[model samples]
Target: MNHEVIGGIPVLWADAPGPLEAVLMFGCGVQDETLRTLGTTHMVEHLAMSTLPRLHHEHNASVDLLTTQFTCTGRPEQVVAFLAAVCEALTALPLERIEQEAGVLAAEDGRVADPATAELLSHRYGVQGLGLAAYRGPGADRIPVEAVQEAVDRFFHRGNAVLVLTGPPPADLRLPLPDGERPDRSAALPVLRTGPSWREEDVPGPGLALHGDLDDPALQLACKLLSQRLRDTVRHRHGLSYDVGGDAVLAGPGHGERTLCLDAREGQEQRVAELLWEEALRLARECPTEDELAEEIAELREVYQDPRSTTCELGEAAGALLFGGTYQDPQTRLAVLEKVTPDEVRQAFAAALETVLLVVPCGTEVDPKLPDGRPLPRRACGTEGELPPGAKVFRPPLVDRLRSSDARRARLAVDGRGLWAREPDGTVHHVPFTEVVGVEMRGPGRVVFGRDTCVIPVVPELWAGIGPAVDAVDAAVPGQLRYPASAFRPAD
Candidate 1:
């Protein structure tokens, strides 16, 4: 492996002597954009490829908090052609197809979520910088053509990019990207007002999701060990959950977010939730055994040594360069893993108790207390307001797809200070506007008020005349209470 500077861009080259794989990574992602410009990078990516000829190779693009990646894999000739075409297309993006590409992005957003990434980031990071995961990406309807062009000029540049390849660089490849300097990607650590918080979500099945904000490598190893213990105890010994595991992800440069998830069977939701807490409490009180640490280290080695495609490895290397992380060989990483002490792992587990955020299945309740005995707040206080007498109350139907016998009916009152909802089983919930931390417009005629403990989903059907109510609430609530829902436009 070697690193060189090509046209002022970093190139990470590795020799695998097989089919060619290439990845071009840019240093700007969602974290680089303000709420107003959220999704601009994505829009540029779409428009860049909107007119490319489909080749007999695998190609895809992805946007993350700190990096955007375009990857291709195939025979050597195919790889060369695909990458060359991408570079040419990026240089002259078809801005005329912006509207069509925006529609495509909207359709992509409506698909079922892979809760592992976005769901976790939203809760752990809050609705601030990277936490936009909780809501939809930038609303394509809001960003104009000028914004997209500016993004391309600022981020898609030689100085801010990295190209990685399994073989040598393609001959005569022309990468005519701009020569802009790398944008500063640093920001203050995300502060969660209700952090170590618990929230529920609409998911396909039952699961217990937890994440901690400790960024140390030793803590990362501890997360792996804890995940294995939960899997063994809950799945094998207790038969309460079908799957359980934990992992640490990079939130930014040198910052790691750890997540532990447990999936429950049909009737074991509550039981699994209870067991998860019990285990967490017990782990906090005791250090892992030496044998446990040894086993985990051995498993880590296996993972590091496992064979993977060169393209995949190159993409990872390129992403690391973009995010201010250095690429570590498997041996170096294993050495670090081996030196981690049991006491260090235990201390990390204990520290994690302070920053834990619990994401449980909807309708499943878990105690929100931290292991060290601090009560988590359930609602935002000042946002609450007194209801005015005879305020206009509007009961709108649930979104068409969500309208079922079991779906609850949501009522929004203009100038009433809050929302009232009734469940199918006769339960009434009053969530005040002051308590709302954020609001998301799900689609046409659908809105969700985000509270600490729950979310209020209101479907103002077409012609329900509830637009005034939404406007009034938006005006009445504090600026931060409205999550950037406008960033997410519904599919056409």
Candidate 2:
């Protein structure tokens, strides 16, 4: 089987294989958000699959504008069929009708929320353009569903595709046409990343959630290190948090750079902020112990060194190949991983001295100190123990008070949908597709999708007396999810 292909396209066939797993990935780099809004790349992906005339395929794809990448991963037999379909769909989606898919494209193009996500992201990216919220990391993270759907319509085009294929093709697969080529691209690739800086906001909580932004090339590696150290020093060493975790958030759809994200229990916001700064200083000045250093290096090596032993991994490799042309070959990845050293990691850590945004959300009632050593203000509760007018409330998901280490259970009836669950605290999980997983029900008749199962949870209703949005991401796993409501409505 061949691993390298000219023009970032390849074919592999093996004679000894019994049932080879075939993978094909396609990628296109995106440079601007306007193209993302145009929906050219998305239409191409959707239509490509439609053209697969004979094969049943399963794949994953995302339209990333930050790096201008559109990736498709699927089987070899279907891929050839896919490309053909895309070529046809570009001119075929009936662009002439404003009544057709064109409107969908327009709707998606209009869905942009210029919010703190970007402001916070900018802190990590520093001056680098990678932090633009319109183009990075699941561009739909906080977007409306209608807008995300529309972005899909405008991306069906010719210029935004990077065809990548890997593994041995099944013998029955055939390629009949002479290879057609897309135009070659130019140099001047913008290096991705942000220099560190701080962005902060307060959340209603007894504890502060400190999240650091990444603008460093070595951010992915830095995240693994800092999170472990911070956990040991702030959360573990002193037992401040109930739980804590740190992860590197990649910004682009294909090969975007990384940012560090983390959450910890509340109460020591001021102390935690100081610890964060001190830890950054410590990482830059004090070298890690040899044992601590070697362990992290080994972990990095495993990400690529692990053999492709399953269809899932192959599918993942295929996705990376198709979407990020930069990572088209498994061997190259393995080779790169094998060559990493400890000194390189230390060097990356030392260089990340610039302070990034430190967002800490502490419950206002906690009397926690801010980084500058100021007391937190009391967050207000709109109303207690109340339901919206004309809404029926089934009891049990809520508890007035409970001793720590206690359990409670209840069933809720909203617009005829029954949601049952247990809560360690008064927090609720935003279940997908219920009139009200927490409150509204996509019910028999919701504001939209009357009976549709795409229930959007009432965005953080009341848990105890504090608005739940403040504790949205950090709560007990919801044992129940209902397919109900489609929009956010405040609890009256």
Candidate 3:
């Protein structure tokens, strides 16, 4: 493992499977102007890298609050050539173009979701101040393109940033970054704040209305666990809302604070709030014993292992290095989790859920008695909306194909393992089918595939990363079957 900083950019060149996948560049720092131009700078990157004329079959790029990553890979020197172009675009990127991009992002920021499932988002992230009220409309003045352009110009500077170039760096790979102090644009790590914030609104849905704003530091992990348990209990077992998972959102770069949210069955809307509180309380009151924690931990580890390093790991690595500002080595990172204790886990859980903000999303059948029985507000989908409403029929075969992929979504926890494919709708597919070898959950919800097993953070997004996912049945097999999100049922 050889590591060095090129042009002040941290670079890690390592030996990997033939035909390298990507050279990920992670750019993240706390800055003021960066927060402002964050959207604009990303817009510039999109225009430059995405539209490269020599692109072969596929290319992808995205920007998050923490970083913006562009991964262009192909045969031999082709990827390196593309890499040079990417660096040029990144270093000499036009501020004007970034400004334009900012406009595009502002438009996205201006979206007001008025869907039947609108309550779902509200209960999940909305009221906790984790709301997603974008002001992307033409008339919407706040968060406009100009504002973002300014921020972009002010952000993205040299710091402890890293640029990981694996496989090969073309003979000619250069960018225009003079080594020096990095400007500050992002915010600082959050200091613990006590108590919860609550809001009321009308929700439209079919089951109970559950609302909560979890303010604890463990909010992120809590979000994943609750979402998993929600799918397990509320959706699968109890049959609550059409969708029954909530979340916690740490604040954006410079504005706002972290939050938590939840929503449930329309009819049970009133009790939904109580349910969330009760669930959180129960977890705290009866914290997972070492045995219970170990079981759950095993399940989590099993989920993180990926067998092959093809399909997804490149994207993930590229994304993390580019946006997360840190390298994610599955084998090494999982080692850290193994050291966590039941006390640490339980204490973290108790601290995060106490005193949080809560929101609830409901269906058309207006619930009059919200937990506070304060009639919740109704958010409508203005005639013109981004996507069409009403439950769109999910094509099962398309989803199954993705699930059946042998590509690695993440590097395996213990090397030589991988994860299953995930669809756009956030569904986890069963890795091994009937003919193929299936992995079992050694404990709790854990699953074992091949020789490796690891705990996977069950939230759909994290589920996408099961270490490095790989499948060996070359030559595409008939992918016509469909499976449910939770297919670990008892077999007779």
Q: lDDT for each of the candidates?
A: 0.64, 0.38, 0.40
| Model 3, position 194: C-alpha lDDT score | 28
Which stretches in model 2 have alpha-carbon errors above 4 Å?
Answer: 1-31, 35-57, 65-83, 96-120, 123-129, 134-160, 170-196, 201-221, 231-257, 266-275, 309-344, 355-492
Cα deviation of 478 in candidate 3 (Å)? Answer: 63
Error of 1 at 9 (Å): 1.4
Q: What is the lDDT of candidate 3?
A: 0.40
Regions of model 1 farther than 4 Å from truth: 33-39, 110-113, 137-143, 204-215, 245-247, 307-313, 373-492
Among the numbered candidates, top TM-score falls to 1
* C-alpha RMSD of each candidate structure in angstroms: 6.0, 14.2, 22.1
lDDT of 3 by residue, 1-492 (tens): 345655656555555555655544445311111211223434545556644666674456655434455665567467666655665555555545544454455455422233322333333332212122211111212223554434334443334345554454555555444344444324433322223333344544222222222222233344445555555665566676455533222233322233224446546765655555556555544544556545555665665563344334444454334333344565564565556665555556555444333444433232332233333343321112122123122222334446655322221121122234333434343223222222222222223221111112222233333222212211121222111122222321
Per-model TM-score on C-alpha atoms:
0.76, 0.47, 0.53
Name the top lDDT candidate.
Answer: 1
lDDT per residue for candidate 1 within 319-401, as digits (tens), equals 67776667777778678778888888778777766666666677776665566677744432123333345777665444632
